[model samples]
Target: MATFTTAFPRGFAIEVLDVYSGPPRIAFKFRHWGYMEGPFKGHPPHGQRVELFGVCIFHVDEDMKVDKSEYFYERGNFLAGFLSCPVMRGN
Candidate 1:
């Protein structure tokens, strides 16, 4: 979590696309975005916006609290965002 903050210090945004409710499972699709204005790992800030699209499903207890969560997304696409900037290309 802290690593993400260092990578997108301005702010990270989430947009919920869809949701399904169930006693045993709740699921949703989402879009997440933020500007890379802070250093990530050893990479310098690139001042570019990065976005992630994915879905999450949660299993809940009888008390309506989440007991487990599963997340699905394209790992390559997410990592590519970090490398797409000019700084990474020696430009």
Candidate 2:
């Protein structure tokens, strides 16, 4: 989380598109938007805009406390976007 905060100093935003609840689990489909302003995953600051879709699932116990969470997103798309930045052209 801290890396994200530093990487996208402009801030990141998530828009929930859909949500589903089943017993003790809740799932969400969302879109994320941000700009790369700092190094990320060893890539230098590129100052490029990034938008991606992802899904997250949260599991809660009987006490209503979240015990686990998982996130899924397209790595290819994300890496492609990062590599597309003009600043990454030489490398």
Candidate 3:
């Protein structure tokens, strides 16, 4: 998370699209978006807005604290967004 903070200094906005289940087990779809205004993995920022969509399943204990979580998403697609650089002026 810290690494992402530096990459997206303005922060990623997260939205829960839908809740599929509740209680001890919870499932949901989500979207997170942010601008690449800061360095990412040593790569310079291109100031491009990026968005990621995914689903997650979480298991909670009796106390309602998350005990485990599983996240599914297109890793390659997300990484590609960062690797793509904007065309520099007069380059």
8, model 3: CA deviation in Å?
A: 0.6
Deviation from native of the Cα of residue 41 in model 2, angstroms? 5.5
Q: On a 0 to 100 scale, what is the lDDT of residue 18 in model 3?
A: 100
Q: Summarize candidate 1's per-residue lDDT along 1-91 as a digit string, tens digits.
A: 8987988887899898999776689999988889999888778888888889999999999998999999999987777788866667777
Model 2: per-residue Cα lDDT at residue 61: 95
lDDT of each: 0.86, 0.84, 0.86
| Residue range 1-91, candidate 3, lDDT tens digits | 8888988999999899999999899999999899988886667788888888999999999999999999999987777777666432323
Which prediction has more favorable TM-score, 1 or 2? Answer: 1
Candidate 2: tens digits of C-alpha lDDT, residues 21-86: 764898999888899898876778778788889999989899878899899999777667688655
lDDT of 1: 0.86
* Residue pairs with clashing backbones, model 3: none
Query: Residue 5 lDDT in model 3?
Result: 93
Off by over 4 Å in 1: none
TM-score per model over all chains:
0.83, 0.73, 0.83
